[model samples]
Target: MKTRNQKGLESKYWLLIIVAACILCMAATFFAGVKSGPVRVIADYTVVPMQKGINVIGTWVNGVADNFVTLKSVQKENKTLKEQNANLKMENNQLQQKAVELERFYDLYKMDQNTSDYPKVGARVIANDGSNWFTSFTIDKGSADGIREDMNVLSGNGLVGIVTKVNAHSSTVRSIIDEVNISSMIMTTFDQCIVSGDLKLINNGVVKFEQLANNENEVAVGEQIVTSNISSKYLQGLLIGYVSEVNVDSNNLTRSGYIIPAVDFKKLQEVLVITTTKQDLIDNGNQTQSDSSEK
Candidate 1:
């Protein structure tokens, strides 16, 4: 530290000597006038450029300081906007979840209204076979809830399937799209047909329909088909599906087609079970099961 102080003092002493020398040179120039030609020329060339270089360096330093201040302000604003964006994303996710739940409740209400006449048991789908079809799935309700074999199951819009197996707490439903199932349906014009499940077509949201009476009755596309009055397991007037394709066979005795089912099997989550069984129909009740055979 002491050495540093001594060096600084020596630097000040040299600066004073340089100033004294400059003053003497100016005095000589004033006395000799233009006659001090070479000295004056040299000073003008060296000093003016040096002073201009110093001014340029000072301007660059000032510019750098101003830019640093502006950069800080921009960084602060960017941080604030990033926080707000994160908050907005979180809020949007919550709203989307609420929307899905609300839609589920609305569907439940519609199913209740459609099956108001029957004393029904509501069940939530708990397990699936993970196949491309809703051929077999387990529900939250079972024998304890009065769910029995061959009981007709319905979804929001129409019939779904029949209960095949029941446990103490849950029941398994074999959806109408199952390959082993068949249904008897009647068109709006009272024309009869046999609807059967086809594994190949279930993935496409349609079932197979055949044995349609080939009469003057026209089975057009989009015509609604419901459980026939003569059905033994399914209730009459319960919508099964809509006619999608219709064509007369080579024999000309019957027409065959595809039907788009009323239940969106892929989206099944909750279902309703009609408390009344097929025996109820045989015992003079309204609903009955289908006993149709494949064509």
Candidate 2:
């Protein structure tokens, strides 16, 4: 709406301000100090404040860049540490398993030496009765390997159980701690005793035994107990366990006690099966007696 003269005046004013700003920028390269009054005032409000704003923006940008780099480095380090921790745990578990395996093998060797009179076959336990302790289990070897029902099973320096069922490919064993009859004898006195399993008391790592003659009092705590020669199914002289407790019955003629089983049922893995049964020995003895009578 203004006339040409008015518009021309306004253009001249803007051109002057631009020229002054350019002159001030060029002067900054050569002069470090401003001594003039008008120039100082203009720089204080305009150029100086603009420089301060630019400095603030640059400092903020630099801080943001540094913080981003630090965050990335921290995340990478955490990931690496977590991976290393997982690997160490896996290695430790493997080492522990190897140690357990070695211990089991050594125990088996000692047991074999103790019962060197019998021919034996080795078998690996395949499955258990779903309890913490292996009260009953199946093995990988069976009829194909000469395994049969009533074959005595051994592990961890003593008797484990007897085979109750046999298949061509696998067999089932009922541990002494299972609900089965066990005929045992004291090694020192050869006194006969009856043994059986109680599921409730087996949690304490022991089984029930009775009919030890109270008159003898010969069976003391810690006495070695083994399968009796008169057992109908299991072979004789296979170590069963050690006596843990003994008490005379109310009738006063018999004593009953608990036996701490030698095998760690919770950790059983491999076992030895005696190929001979008590019935085989009994038949052999009968044959020898008959031959002697004829002679």
Candidate 1 lands at a TM-score of 0.70
- Residue lDDT tens for model 2, 1-295: 4798899999999999999978877676224257567767766667776778999999999999999999999999999999999999999999999998988888888888888998899999999989988889999998999998888899968988999999998999998888877888899998899988778788988888898887744677899998898888878888888999999999999899899988888888899999888777888999999999999
After superposition, candidate 2 runs with Cα above 4 Å error: 1-23, 33-60, 130-133, 283-295
- How would you encode candidate 1's per-residue C-alpha lDDT over 2-114 as one tens digit per residue? 99999999999999999998996666545444445676676556654655788899999999999999999999999999999999999999999889767876776787786
Candidate 1 Cα misplacement greater than 4 A, ranges: 1-73, 76-80, 281-295
The residue pairs that clash in candidate 2, if any, are: none
Query: Each candidate's lDDT (Cα)?
Result: 0.81, 0.87
